[model samples]
Target: MSTFRTASRVDGNQSTIVASLRRIGCTVLLTHQLKNCFDILVGYRGRTHLMEIKDPAQPPSKRKLTPGEEEFRRTWQGSPYHVVETIDQAISIVTAP
Candidate 1:
C-alpha cells in the first residue's frame, strides 16, 4: 500500500478544517488520491458529503478545477458536493440541518 501524506499546498487552513471536523464528531476522510476525486469525504449523522478544497486567497477567476475534478463532479450523483475555502464553510455544509 502507498503511504499517504498531505499535499504540499495543503497548509494550515486545510489542516484546521480537518481537525475541527473531527472534533465536531464528523468522520473526515482525506481523499487526495491518484484518481480523479474530491478532496475530502465527510460522514455525519448518516449523511455523506464530498468536498473540494480550495485556497481562500486564490482569486475565483484563477481557481480553475482540474479536468478530472470536473468530470467527477459532473458524473457524481451522490450526496451534495461543495467547494469550501474555509473551515467555517466546511462546517456549515457538513452540519446543515
Candidate 2:
C-alpha cells in the first residue's frame, strides 16, 4: 500500500482563490497543513501576502477563526495577514497597487 498522506480539508473557496491568483500571475502555495497558521502564501510583483480562506457560504459568525488560527494570528509577528472569503477579494489583494 502507498504511504502518502492527504492534507487537511480546506475552505470551499480556497481552490478557486488559488487558481484565480495563479491565473493573475501570482505564485500560490498551500500552507494549510501548518499548525495554527495561515492557509495560503501568495507572491506577486516582489511582494508576499498571507491569506486565511473563509467560506462565504457560511454565516459571518460561522466563519470565525478556529482557536488555533486565532492563536496564530494573535502571535504572528510578521506583516499583516488577510482573511478572504471570495475570489474577488483574493484577486484584489495580489493585484492591488
TM-score of each: 0.81, 0.85
Clashing pairs in 2: none
Per-model root-mean-square deviation over C-alphas: 3.4, 4.1
Query: On residues 1-97, what C-alpha lDDT tens digit does candidate 2 reach at each position?
Result: 3232255668888889899899889998899877778899999999999999999898988689889789888888885689999999988887788
Scored by Cα lDDT, where does model 2 land? 0.86
How far in Å is the alpha carbon of 17 misplaced in model 1? Answer: 0.9
Q: Locate the minimum summed-lDDT window of 10 residues in model 2.
A: 1-10
Kindly list the per-residue Cα lDDT of model 1 for residues 1-97, writing each as its tens digit. Answer: 4344344344236778889999999999988654667788999999999988887677776456678778889988888778888889999998889
Candidate 1 TM-score, C-alpha based = 0.81
**Which stretches in model 2 have alpha-carbon errors above 4 Å?**
1-7
Worst 10-residue lDDT window for candidate 1 reads 2-11
Top lDDT hit: 2
In order, candidate lDDTs are: 0.79, 0.86
Total backbone clashes of candidate 1, pairs 3 or more residues apart or in separate chains: 0
